[model samples]
Target: MTIRVLIADDQDIVRTGLTMLLNAQPGIEVVGAATDGRHAVRLARQLRPDVCLFDIRMPLMDGIEATRRLAGPDVADPLPIVVITTFDLDEYVHGALKAGARGFLLKDAGPELLSQAIRSAAEGDALIAPSVTVRLLAAFADSQKEPPTQPVEPLTAREEQVLIPVAHGRTNSEISAELHISPSTVKTHVAGLMRKLGARNRVELAMWAHETGRA
Candidate 1:
């Protein structure tokens, strides 16, 4: 199935480059492009694309607020969004995740990784750039004034194994290979982790893993 995508970036060249790059990939289509956050939101609501790729900084509104409007906790039906940014600042990462982005990537993430991220988000999985995943999440956890919330129930050993790779941004297939388990089993353990940790998504699960020093 072709994954329709919306691109939102203020830079004309960047937006154009992304559209061209995604369109060149198999089974991916750039359905819409937006120059700013509000335009992106409007296009997203109207197009209902499979994924929305947003830049962190934009005029009129920022990607974080745009993500919140479409995918925030209060939204009736949240859309999947992946935030791509030039800056690797912790605040941008934290804000985008808090606002409901399904994935996060640095602008220089190559075409293959970018495509993978889009596919992952479309498949209800989340990816964070591996280069920044460990450092940024650890920093966020340390900077939190309040202690990380404890899981409702302790994680089983299998679940603990799954959490480490997941916190490192491995996909289900990757984790399954690493742990010598089936993808379905990996998914089951992921779901259990989410339930016990009260995580809204894989991103939150990853954050919890860092917060509690499990990863």
Candidate 2:
């Protein structure tokens, strides 16, 4: 199935480049491109794309607020969003995640990583750029002493097997190879764990793993 995407970036060059890069990929389509956050939100609600790509800094409104409006905790129905930005500051990462962005990537994360992030988000998984994954999660995990209020049911052994590497930032394909399971099976396990743990996305799952000392 084609994964439709809407991109929001203030820079004309960046927006255009992302459009071209994503549109060239198979099974991916750029449904709309917005020059600012307000436009992005408007277009996203109208287009109802499968995934939304946002740049952290934008005019009219910032991507963080836009993400909050579309996918934050209070929203009745949340759209999947991936935040792509030139800056990888801890504040931006934390803000985006809190605002319910399902993925985060650096602007220079390359086409392969960008594509992987889009696919992962489309599949209802989260992907953080490997460069920022460890540090961001560790920092986020360190700031909070209380256990997450999300996880209710305990994880099974098989689920525990999957959780460790995922917390370490392993992708589904990598996890499948390491566990000698099909990629689809990895996905199934991931979905199961997310539901059981009440994780909104993979980043939250990773955070849970760390917070619980399971990683």
Candidate 3:
């Protein structure tokens, strides 16, 4: 199936660049583009694109507010959103997640990563780049005593081990190497972990890990 996406960014150049790059990928289409946060939300709600790529700053409203309105836990039925921005600040990253972002990406994360993030979000996964995640999360951790409140649940020892490295932005291949397991095994463990934790994607898993002081 073709993955439909909506791009929300204020800059014309950024919009054009993202649309062009995403359009070039197979099985992906830029269904709409919004010049500001409000329009992004309107277009997203109306179109119900598979994924909405949001920029943090925009006119009329900010991406964080728009994301919350569309995808927050209170939204009844939330759509998946992936935040895109040039800033890599911890506040922006954490705020985006709180507002119901499925993933966060640097504006310059490049075309390959951009494409990957869209597909991942559409598949109920998140594609956070390793480097950006580490810094963003560490800063978030330092500023908090506990992560945002989530339901209490027990996790296996093996899952706990897998969860920390994921918060540190380790990929399946890296986790496999660290735990001396195959990548497929890591994927299985990840899926199991998400199910147990009620997480939509890796980003939530990592966020919970950090929130729980495990990351």
CA lDDT, candidate 1, residue 117: 94
Ranking by lDDT: 1, 2, 3
lDDT per residue as tens, model 1, 73-176: 89999999999999988889889989999899998999999999998888777888887777866676667888888889989999999999988889987898
Q: lDDT of all predictions, in order shown?
A: 0.91, 0.89, 0.84
Instruction: Flag regions of model 1 displaced more than 4 Å.
Output: 144-148, 180-185, 210-213
Q: State, as a TM-score between 0 and 1, how close model 2 is to the true structure.
A: 0.87
Regions of candidate 2 where Cα sits further than 4 Å from its true position: 140-151, 180-188, 191-200, 208-214
Residues 47-95 of candidate 2: C-alpha lDDT, one tens digit per residue:
9999999998998999999999999999998999999999879899889
Look at candidate 3 and give me any clashing residue pairs.
147-211
Q: Which candidate is the best by TM-score?
A: 1
Residues 20-47 of candidate 3: C-alpha lDDT, one tens digit per residue: 9999999999999999988998999999
Clashing pairs in 1: none
TM-score of each: 0.88, 0.87, 0.77
